[model samples]
Target: MSTYMAFVYGILYLLFTTFTFVFEDAYGFTQSNVGLVYIGIGVGMLLGLAVLGSASDKIAIGMAKSHNNGVIKPEYRLPALVPGGFFVPVGLFLYGWAAEKHVQWAVPLLGTLLVGIGIIVSFMCVQTYLVDAFTVHAASAIAANTVLRSVFGAVLPLAGLKMYSKLGLGWGNSLLGFLALAMCVVPFFFVRYGERIRTNPRFQVKL
Candidate 1:
């Protein structure tokens, strides 16, 4: 689940990094204007982290309380992904097609904002889930997740130009949105079967 979350994060970064060019070419945004637009993403991410990060803990505790004995399962963290899963693709679709159609600049910017919120929400949930699931070996789990997503982030941008050129922003981002949509299944799977999966002997680690 963490790996899949990282992969989506990679795609989100790819879309974000390339948006400068997209804004300039498609909407004729000046460099300063583009920078201002980017501030929206930063602000969105900050708010998302603040809200969702704390919410995850509250949710886990609530779930634990519901269990009578107050034992929290890592799977409880996954419900946070629900809002993110729905919004990420919606934001991507809006960003891509709005840009492609040259809709009002605010339209795409709103999409960017949603994308920012969605990505951070998903990221926070995944990180929390991994830490809760691998209490003793969380460092290794996070390191692996970081490495995989970093590779995707580094490499995927190289194709951004060609992808947008051939497919146009609409289809290119739609492709990404579709991928993100598919990744939503990861959390659902974990929510349903995570405890059983964690019971495997291979997952056990000494502190």
Candidate 2:
């Protein structure tokens, strides 16, 4: 789940940063006003936090209470991930095509809003799942997650200017959206088989 989250977030980070370019080139926003447009994403993130802040724990505790063994597994935290998975790709497609067609700025901003919601919800669930799964090793697991995401964040964007240039925002981000769509399966896989991975000797990490 951590590995998959890293890859997914890398793409999102790419989109987030690249939006500045989108605003400038596509919408003719000046440097001063570009920052204002980002409020849409901020609003979305806040909404995500508000919804998931209590809901994630409630879901986890409820599942644990209902479990035959009454023990909570980290997997319970991931069901919320399903919503985030959908938000991200759909948001990307909206943001991309909206920008390509030069729709209303609010349309693109709305797309960013959904992306923001997805980002925060996903981030929270991933971190919580890591903490519940690894306990003492949570920090290490997070460090690994951070490192991989950073690598992707750094490397993927280097291609942004070229990618957007060649593929255009519509197809460039759509390509990423499709990749993200495929990756949406990751959370379900974890929820279903996380224990098997944790228990299997070959899958066990050094930590």
Winner by lDDT: 2
Give Cα-based local distance difference scores for all models. Answer: 0.83, 0.84
Cα misplacement distance, residue 30 of candidate 1 (Å)? 1.4
Model 2, which residues run further than 4 Å from truth?
Answer: 203-207
lDDT of 1 at 117: 88
TM-score of each: 0.93, 0.93
Candidate 1, residue 178: how far the Cα is off, in Å? 1.0
Query: Candidate 2: TM-score?
Result: 0.93
Give stretches of model 1 more than 4 Å off.
none
Residue pairs clashing in model 1 are none
Q: Where does candidate 2 clash, by residue pair?
A: none
Residues 84-185, candidate 2: write the lDDT tens digits. Answer: 777888888999999999998999889888888888888898888888888888899899989988888788877777988899989987998898788889
